[model samples]
Target: MSDLLIGGAETSTLAALASPVTVIDSTTSCQDVDELFRADEHLGCLAVHGDGPGRSLGLVSRVPFQHLMSGRLGYGKLLNTRRPVSALTDWSPLVVHAATGVAEVARQVLDRGSSQRFSEVLVADPGAPLRQVSVTDVFRALSGELATKALTDALTGLANRDHFLQRLQQCCTAPDVRRRLALVYVDLDGFKAFNDGHGHGVGDLVLQVVADRLRGCFHPGDLVARLGGDEFAAVVQLPAGVPVGPAARQLGERVRACLSGTISLSSIVLPGRASVGVAVASSVLADGETLLREADLAMYRAKAAGGGRVELVTDVGSTAPREQFAPDRRELQRAVDEGEFLVHYQPIVEVGTGRLASVEALVRWQHPRRGLLAPGAFLGAVADAGFAANLDLHVLEVALAQFSRWQRNLGRAAPRAVNVNVSVQGLLHPRLAPAVLDALSRAGLDPAVLRVELPEAATTTQLDVVRGALGTLRAAGVRLTLDDLGAGASSLHHLTRLTLDGVKIDRRFIAGLLDDERDAAVVVMLLELAHSTGIAVTAEGVETRPQLEALQEMARGRPTFVQGHLISRPVAAEEIALPWSGGLHHLHAHVPGPRSAVPTAPGPVASS
Candidate 1:
């Protein structure tokens, strides 16, 4: 909050005051001067000069510069940390002409320092063009009142969101800020659960505990801030000699153990834990935002990997990256434009009969560079960035068209049934049934021949939407299958309310069905429930001989179905083949028009 000063008559204040400066166009190398600053034992300061002859642009301090050089800034440690001294000098030593009042100079100082990485202000006289007028050092000139008002978080007495953002931006924009940085985004696990179980009083206590734990984790030079609610962020400049990764790992582990460990209050133990997403940017990250994103993503990964554990933020270039959700949205549009996405089909065969009852339509990405990637590689990206609905619609259209062709070839008696897995959006969308019915009618395909599958875990809070959609689908003769049922709680309510055509037991529950007693018992119970409801059961992920045998035993004297790698893996659309002969098991001919899209390599179905 110090008055941003410039030598000019008047200037508007910048968003942030303390930021690093990089000379995008400088004649002198700051490297030699930077080394000098690092080696200095007292009054550590860096004087930056602009590109023009005999011109000083701005100055930087030793502490912030040290933070940048040591990799303690934003994602500074992950990617390239150093920039040409010329770049630093080009923007540094900001010049403001004299005749500028203290208020005007303050505003200019604020505006310039808001983005650049400099803690001090340089005033120049207008009459002398770049001559010095006065110096307003950051810590020395800024009053305590202004500092308190600008930096402190009103709720937690830590750094506020704006201050954190500005500081992080500087670390990201600063030259060599990426040399080393350990950025962490922390969220208290089950904090909401506390509110649900013990009311707001307990929730507030939980927040306080989290705040205290975070405060205890840093040094005097480190920054700890409450971004809001139960979320907090931290930026620590690690010691030059210390390795960034190990130190960060230690801190993350401590955070996990300390937060999750039981806390006793008035003899009532609160089972509190936290999920921390950590990203080391010193060597891999490019900016503060990227660093924060990586940490947030890693934290989510940690939570997904089962909370109370730490995960390193790797897979920078893979689908796991945050940008995975927002890749050139243009690229997605381009993919659709170029028809780079292709439909593949996997047969959903009956277990004992080994006969194909239907095929599951799956999407494959024909990425120009990545070769062929599965939906897992890019579907989440599309879905998360608000494109799933369109993509799902496209898949449905393609699937219906393919089924129409397949049914025509199979003659009048052939089953037109095609199973297409819909995303959560499609399942929950109010227009889903109408959309599917319209596709079926347009294709002249039987609605009964189309089975729609939805992932159980993806269901949203609007259970009624799914119920209504599924009800409409059922009434229209389009079969509905609750996919990945055992992977999550699909709730018997959905099953009973919607009158589903069937349930596809998740691969996880059916995996190794012959051995796991618990999985086997669940499968049996599911089979009984399906039978009582007059619904068919399809066992998914059945791979081994024992698994098939177990399924057969369960289906003995009963009508049940199975789908997995043991029968066939998903394959390209054109590769899908049906037997010419009436007998189910004979594949005696070799026609090259198209191979079955099923996976040729013999691997067990994915562990559910």
Candidate 2:
């Protein structure tokens, strides 16, 4: 290990540092292993591996181990001696392979969110026992190789693209931005032409010169980077209290001048110019990629209008590029990690006696800058991002967990079950059934208390997918319902082909069910279809007393449920307990009135 460290951390591979380590049985008691740490002060932690079936690995750090055993006033050593090591093991360690470059491993180790930055790392080598590597050893070698290899541009002596992006995320993510964060994107307008015309030597020199000028353009608090080739970017902090647009433009102009100014290459002067684009975030409600993209788009616009000028984008979301506004899978993944997604519940009540039927779970994205966003704003984007399956599972877990909480509090009074929507992609995901069942098992909740809703006409063409995913769920005593009944596909075909516990009359028909004959006809037909099929019916988007009265009049003694602004809009989990116990309470979310606070850039946004 010392030889590998001395040889050079960058060039050495992780395989070289791999050392055989003892693996503790996961079922071993803490008291039995207490003497292991006391006997060896140098032992940082021990690896614990479970037996067959659900064979999993974990790490028990000396600190947490000792703390747990010590107890208050140190009595836990005797009382908690028999506790299994698996109970206290950290299961989610960042695993790596032996063939991985030490530099890469170090970067992965240190690049995690600070809370998890120092989690355990196990080097898995084929034909060998899983060996553990101390994080302290990784940190010791960080100084020698990390600065030049991972962060700094070797040729230009500036922050590299990765480092620049990290800094930009930091600026955009700051809880309070003081409304002074901005991004500057610089593209050397004719550098490629000049580089191709000249040799590689001249091209390299030009890049170094551009890097130097960029350095001069940004200050001590700013981050400037060579985003590969001729493109460079900066995350700048403007002087507080000044207008962001003006200040950003002023800085952009300086960068333009600095790059286009004096460039004498071996007594031959070259026109070193750049198209500079500036985007200013007036508030903390900004996304790193969105801001960078805004600046990049502005730069392109400047280049299109003829080079060597600065383009500024002041209005963030409205005037910024439209592509960034759309939902992105990567953005959704980040939102899940950052916990920007939250669940809201709307009461579904029986129309006859106003008895609490169930609560449908609605997913909302709570943006740091925007109060809350409905499914209309980003669900399509999530689906487009190909994250529909993952997001659906995440939402299912959240809704199920919330239902468990309610069941804990209200006992019998809690809504009978939680109805959660599952997208078509999620319904097709192989892991859906097992994951849902596992969650229910872990929560000690009955599968009957969880109702998974599938869009009615969504999978008509793919009955195989429907059968494969829904079959296991149905067999487990889980209720399956069809949402937006007449919204898509063939309603009658679905009623006959699919085994549904209930069907939601599409919101479109209910919106004007009383006044529109065609809509009334559609609702009546849907009710007849569901009733004849022995499935319950839910009238969605029921807003007024007239609509409710009209629907109740049409009911032919079948189990009918209604949900919409009429009974109450969706509310937070804690606030939902009221409607559960009260049976017919109209719940509402007190939020600032309707406003489209679309992110100018993608930052923290929605989930399922």
Best by lDDT: 2
Q: What ranges in model 1 sit over 4 Å off?
A: 1-325, 328-330, 412-416, 458-460, 580-608
| Model 1 Cα shift for residue 252 (angstroms) | 11
How much does candidate 1 score in TM-score?
0.48
**Per-residue lDDT for 22-65 in model 2, tens only?**
68998898877788889999777788887655458777778778
* lDDT, residue 472, candidate 1: 78
| Model 2 residue pairs with clashes | none
For model 1, how does the per-residue alpha-carbon lDDT over 1-608 read when each residue is reduced to its tens digit?
Answer: 12211111111232123233333234334455456665656544545555565543555555655555556455532332345444433244555544343334433444443344335454443343233322333222222222343355433567766678767756654545545666777887766776788776766666666667667766655667888777888865444676666777887887777677777667567776778877776444434667777888888888887777887663232333233234556778788789887887766666556556777777877889877767755775787666677778777888888778767777754433688888776667768888888988998877888888766655446656567777777888888888765553334435644567888876755753664444565567567657655787888876566677777787765778876655556666655556411222332232121243435333433211
Q: Residue 274 lDDT in model 1?
A: 75
Error of 1 at 185 (Å): 21
- Poorly placed runs, candidate 2 (over 4 Å): 1-320, 326-328, 369-371, 577-608
What is each predicted model's overall lDDT from 0 to 1? 0.61, 0.71
